[model samples]
Target: MTSHADQPNVARTLTGQSGGEIPRDDWSAGRGRLFLLLVAPSVLLLVLLNAYPVFYAALQSVRNGTLISPGEFVGLSNFAKVLQSPDFWHSVRFTAIFTVSGVAGSWLIGMALALLLRAGVYGGGTVKVLLLLPWVVPIVVSSMAWNWLVATPDSPMPTLARMLGFETPLFLADPLLAAITVCVFKVWCSFPFMMLIMSAALSGIDRSVYEAASIDGATGWQRLRYITLPLTARTTYISWILMTIFCVNDFPTIYLLTAGGPIDATTSLIVLAYRLVFQNFQTGPGVAIALMMTAAMVVVSLILFRQIRKSGGPA
Candidate 1:
């Protein structure tokens, strides 16, 4: 007499059933339907919210139009005009500089702060809250405060410069100084975000790994360079991608601080697009610039995403 364990399908055979388990094909089909059902609402929402605007913008980009009217289609002439414009190139240059500075400066400062905090410094919780104030404050309030700090010769920054026997630098007036100020401001506002992300990543690292490395005679710098950085690489890549997007798309920082300024000195692509659409009422060219920026952003995001996958392991 064989036991049931020796014949797992014995009950099904005795009961004249096909099998005790659902068919693989049927199970897969059922799961596929459930997946579709679960995601359908989100997909529909994305189509309505994101896809429609992008489609409308793509349509408007190739046409001569005002905000109120979709004028006749001109077939890439808007793109051509934007490409030929000197102001567009100027904006692109500033945007590149601003994005690079913001990403690098924020990451360096934030990572340093994160490492410092990881060492269990005194009153680190209080310090972290203080650090976050730059990011947590309303952007409008922050912008207003920054303007008061540097906008005039009578402002504190220029006043300090005068006290130091230096010619009062027109931070928002001079092209180069305005660009530097905007980039620095972006880094200041953004570093706290980077700090939070890095802090989380650092906390997830096992302390034992560092203890073992120390046993092997690894110095502090060596542990950081070899162990800490490698362990946090995926997070680093992700943070860089986010910060890059933030810096590239940041309009308010530059606009509020400088209004693209004394002679359009700090106009980023977004600012230029805004000036064209809202200020100049050139909808077609404005949308064209915006679409170009979107394309560039997509390309950059893809590149960084690939790096993230690489850092995380086999895709």
Candidate 2:
């Protein structure tokens, strides 16, 4: 429908050449300005939400005192004290145990479930949705449900244990049992996330590779060990790193369940920080502990980022 006279303008626009009806440089400048205007508010909000508290916390960490007095700039004494504390080390040990156990348990279960589903289990869609229910539920609600199931003497778990002839059924009262219980709870809530990721990774893998391997006389176990795990190794590592951070920073689950009870057996660093600041009124040490945890997380995140890049994951 274009006439010969109007063809030049249409051709220029189609080729991204803006000189016919608009100057090319001016159009580009306008687009750049529009992009900046649209993005600036979000950038500003992100800085305020994330950076400001970090700076404030850093400043607070150096000052010694209760929250009100904030005594004086102690020049890392707070951090030194925290590092030297037996209680801090105890919490650190438990935190490591909790994080490792949770990450490993969740990942294993998730991968297993993924494999089962990948093999085309009956009712796979329904099962997948059911598995995610725990995760979708509020943490407080989930913690309370778990508490009801195990914490009390007349609880179903204890009642079942008593009926089964076990004398002591205080699952949350014993130190080792408490630690295990928390780890199990963490796995229960976390496995769905891992399953979703592993499933996606498995799906992306070309089935033809497995077909080829099988044609070459690869058995079921052999294909799994050689093909599946290797192909999904990067995703598995990513899941581990992510779940490690989640377990490390998790507070609500432990707090609502145990409150670090039974001699501080389930106390993670986050719980310890909360206790120091709010319960003990030691703001300086609390902030220092938090900052130390932040530093540790940063180190772990950097390692993970490097690995992700090496594995060709998104930046």
Candidate 3:
């Protein structure tokens, strides 16, 4: 007699497959196969379009020429030069300032707007719709609009400043001011995305949680502190990370606004890379800078991910 451990269920024998077992109760197996089948095309496209170009840029960073003209294999020379070059360092510094400022500004303003709008006060929907307008506008159109608005002599902000008795500050002319200008514009243009994300996350939160807190003698601030924020922290962290990356990579607005500026003052890494690749035709250094930017962003993202995970949450 066969051991019970070796015997197949009686249901298997009815199918006329001797000693065969039914499939394990792993629900994900079939779904996983189907998911891979569905995602294969997208994965292939991503590899071809994004991954391939990134790898190609990394490869090109080592050599010293354009696609049309072959040059010497300089190994790490391009990266070293990029790191040490004054212009590249300036760009890196500007990029860091812009990224940090823009991310903080966007998150702060967006979170405020999200919280206010979530209170369902008067005109909340209208305010949300208006806030979304910036995000819906094309970047080029928005860039041009900002350029016309601020860079022009007769723009609103300057006019208002003059009217208020303060000397009209040339927003785009000064390097420090230009950086602040870019940060403000970036925040204005980007906050809608954060607001939307925060709104969704806020909506998913259970009202019962707040009610439960209220019944326990929790004040409004107490409810927000203990219950609302912790539950929403993960989404907020993700929003901040995404905004940081976008701020790091933002180009069109700054490019169109200042073209890296009155004296390369406004140039960040992206603009610097553009100047290298297109203006100066230095493909190797350009690719090196791009790779550096990508690596930095990856590191920041990893740090945030680890922190979020350590907070006993999934991000």
Candidate 4:
């Protein structure tokens, strides 16, 4: 019963409500298909590149096998042997020390640097650039530089100490000092990343919060302690988790500088695994150690992720 004029009006109404000639429902179907197409390749690639290798390694770790030797279904025997080894124990101890010290140092230094940069102080840009330089440089190059600086007998640090009328402290000679040196260098190399992340997080804060705090006579330290720090908790937590993983797995700095020596004093879990796998050709224990380290990192990451989610957040 509708006339041509009424038909045109009905068509215009439908188009107006839909926001275009195409219906919103139709647009959604097309967008969904496009998204699926875009994501499919990445999903497949991840499965092939990451998931497969992980499951394969897990399978290999359970069985007595090698790239060169025949396989046997040993089933946790390797894990048992690794748990009892003295070298493994030493590596674990070193790893704990390294993870704790390195991560803590990185967190503190990063926070300090971020705060300094945020303060609009003089030379802030220059300092940030210089700090970032270490992180950008290749790990091998940084480790080499550290090695030269800490070399025995007439090294730069020692010479500087002597010039300042202080006795030369052997950096890599004493085991304790050597470990400390590694931790310090790692902190220097790592803090920049933390600084960068924390700075970004700081930028996202509501400026009004700070203004209000100031109007209420909140001191600088009080503002930072209560407002800024709490707001930055997520970023700080993430930095801690990442730094811990990296510290635990880091081999280049420890290997190049101290080689975990001075009687295995600086040796870490990753370094010990590298030595076993490559140096001694003990593939079994080496693989086992690597797997254990990986498992630890995974567990820690999962815990952190859960905590983040539970706090009404996502990372």
Which structure among the candidates has the greatest lDDT?
1
Each model's C-alpha lDDT?
0.91, 0.89, 0.84, 0.84
TM-score of 1: 0.91
Task: Estimate, for each residue in 71-173, the C-alpha lDDT of model 1 and write its tens digit.
Answer: 9999989999999999999999999999999999999999999999999889999999999999999888999999999999999999999999999999998
Question: Model 3: which ten-residue window has the lowest total lDDT?
Answer: 8-17
**Cα lDDT for residue 296, candidate 4:** 92
Winner of 1 and 3 under TM-score = 1
- Residues 129-219 of candidate 2: C-alpha lDDT, one tens digit per residue: 9989989999989998999999889999999988999985788999888988998999999999999999999999999999999899999
lDDT of 4 by residue, 155-232 (tens): 898889899999888899988898889888888788888889999989888889999999999999999999988888
Error of 2 at 225 (Å): 2.4
Candidate 3 runs further than 4 Å off: 1-45
Reference-based TM-score, model 3: 0.86
Error of 4 at 19 (Å): 16
lDDT (10s digit) by residue, model 3, range 47-158: 8998888777878899999857757799999999998899988888888888888888877787778888878778888878999988899988988887777775588878
Instruction: At residue 80, give the lDDT of candidate 1.
Output: 98
TM per prediction: 0.91, 0.90, 0.86, 0.86
Provide the RMSD of all predictions against the true structure, rounded to 1 decimal. 3.1, 3.5, 3.9, 4.1
Better of 2 and 4 by TM-score: 2
